[model samples]
Target: MNSNAIKARKKVLVILTQSPYGNALSREAIDYCLAAAAFEQDLTLLFTGDAVLQLINDQNPSTINQKDLTKTLSALPIYGINQFYVDSNALEQYGIDNDFCVPTIKVDVKEISELLVNADTILNF
Candidate 1:
């Protein structure tokens, strides 16, 4: 009921576990994050499972005539959504080197758990 509480922006965590290019889920999730960021919400984007692929650089989705999601992801900072976290296990599982990914914090499952617990709002895709 206090003014401060009423004006506070919720901490929103977006967990993306799907791969980009093959489907539209990643694109939609990115759109959601951007929309939430436009509202000035505290946003954090976690790339896990196959979603880690979205952070990889130099993707040429244009070969398949699909828009490059990684390119879109690189624009997140402009939207004020720069908190990027990647699951270390997923990176290893997919044989993806972190050097190929965008600016991100490689995290273990335990740290991911901590993030989920601290988030005020969580959206998974």
Candidate 2:
């Protein structure tokens, strides 16, 4: 590789569909997002299905001997990862309204489809 070569940044969409704390998938997904952002990748995160639970404020993972994910999520903006989305349908199903630990855009099915179609890469967790 040439030293002067510039790597093209890719539009990466990371979809999280699992519940937090039941296992390590949610944490691993977050780690992947942080790593990709560190490399200057254009990253977007979508929380759908049970993943919507990850966004709720005042999570208490310490009681279960796990690290608090909300704290990690709140630090995403510092890594230039400002594009966070939650499926509107999921929010409705889960009855979540304006209590997210971090700022997130609520995307309808059409917008979610557009996001998937437009991304250069998609990662699901």
Best by lDDT: 2
lDDT of 1 by residue, 9-47 (tens): 788889998989877999999988878888888998899
Q: What tens-digit string does per-residue lDDT give for candidate 2 at 1-125?
A: 87457766678899999888997999899988889888888898999999999999988988989999989888888999887899999999978778888889999999999999999999999
Residue 95, model 1, lDDT: 92
- Candidate 2 accuracy as lDDT: 0.90
TM-score of 1: 0.91
Worst 10 residues of 2 by lDDT: 1-10
TM-score of each: 0.91, 0.92
